[model samples]
Target: MPRERHGTPPVGSRPMMSIDGLGDLWDTLFGAQTDPPALLVLITGAVALVVVSTRLPWRIARNAITIAHEGGHALVALLTGRKLHGIRLHSDTSGLTLSAGRPTGPGMILTLLAGYVAPPLVGLAGAWLLGGNRITLLLWVAVALLLAMLVMIRNVFGVVSLLITGALVFAVSWYATPQVQAAFAYAGVWFLLLGGVRPVVELQRLRSRGRMPASDADQLAGLTPFPPLFWVGVFALVNLAALLAGALLLAGPFLTDAGLTL
Candidate 1:
């Protein structure tokens, strides 16, 4: 029998975190309200999502986060002189990835970092590309939603994800102005960073489950445990700084003219 977890929350029946009608009601409730600052609310909401995501009982339910982690392993394998095998994904709580080539210390570590943080940055980029005007934002959001529908019809979640990314762009577009798009962009970077580190906590859960997902390096070269702590700490600090710099680039847009003069 699968061992029960210490503090695992009751798993939700929904495949994804159903926002219910929250997204639809945004313009009416929070959008209509003043001075709590819609952007602050956005930031708060974004942070809350990340926190909630970490607490999720199943990786399948939080596929994006799992993908990010597995992607990191693939990246680390590539850098360390290896190849990706393929992905194993699920609806909310579980995943097991197969990869060829194991990361030699340095490469494996970086790949780990990659999976942790890539998603939110992807969100930020989406926001940036959508542009900040309201009509454009709404239009793009519609486009993404329609595209996501086509993806659903095709029975391809990845395709659905691709089309839905326009929604990320919509996030920045819906904000007060183009000037703050960077903030949203940075916000994505921050989301990625948080997601990446989340697995540290997940590590404990994995230990109890008696499974360690092999990365590209582990598959290709054979399983060797994740490197020692000092290296991991060094890995953490370096990635943290890199992500911060990335966030700055996002935040910088508000401060810089960045070609908006018409």
Candidate 2:
């Protein structure tokens, strides 16, 4: 009897693996999932709120926000034609994004402004995706962004942080059940929306105390006519507005189903 073949398939044979993978990728990117229960949404929001409000958890969670913060700077810098050098994330949850370009221009101003408001803006985008029942898409998009950011991380800590965060997101998007994915996605968006505001508030406090003199708001002040406090107020307003808008998008369906309006 001929030995049984246990090797690779002959050329021109059906490429089932590639076909199946493409199908899976298509579904994962564009599939519409059922909405998570309203209770789950509320619970996630509550958990995110507690995390943001509590100091210890906030310290830990702030790393994620810092990622978004620096990412925002890097993104805007590139968008505005600045040459992005790299990004550094610190253990203290602080981050620095270095870029080279015209020092005093609209591009520079926008890049400086991007850091403080990036989280909430990103949260709003996530909320919109969730509202459309694209939970998996949101998760995968996050993972993709992290992976892209990882390429530009200049410091050991930054690379490690991105790797950890990206791994968590990829694991959930790949291995977790739908319910688990939904929960994780909602909680993360909630955290971003809620967590985004705290840093701006902290910046104001530090600035008022005459600390953090060279902060983003101060840098913006130097380029523009506005004072540092004025820029801080602008950041607060944008973040707060994003929070409100994101909340409405995330909760609107639940409210409508329950015969409510806000």
lDDT of each: 0.43, 0.91
- Overlapping backbone residue pairs in candidate 2 total 0
Candidate 1: where are CA atoms >4 Å away? Answer: 1-61, 75-83, 101-187, 204-228, 231-235, 253-262
In model 2, the Cα lDDT at residue 260 comes to 92
lDDT of 1 at 61: 26
| Candidate 2: pairs in clash | none
What lDDT does candidate 2 reach at residue 20? 80
lDDT per residue, candidate 1, 143-170, as tens digits? 5543533322222454444345555556
Residue ranges of candidate 2 with Cα displaced over 4 Å = 1-16, 260-262
* TM-score of each candidate structure, all chains considered together: 0.44, 0.92
Q: Write the per-residue lDDT of candidate 2 for residues 158-204, one digit (tens) a residue.
A: 99999999999999999999999999999999999999999998998
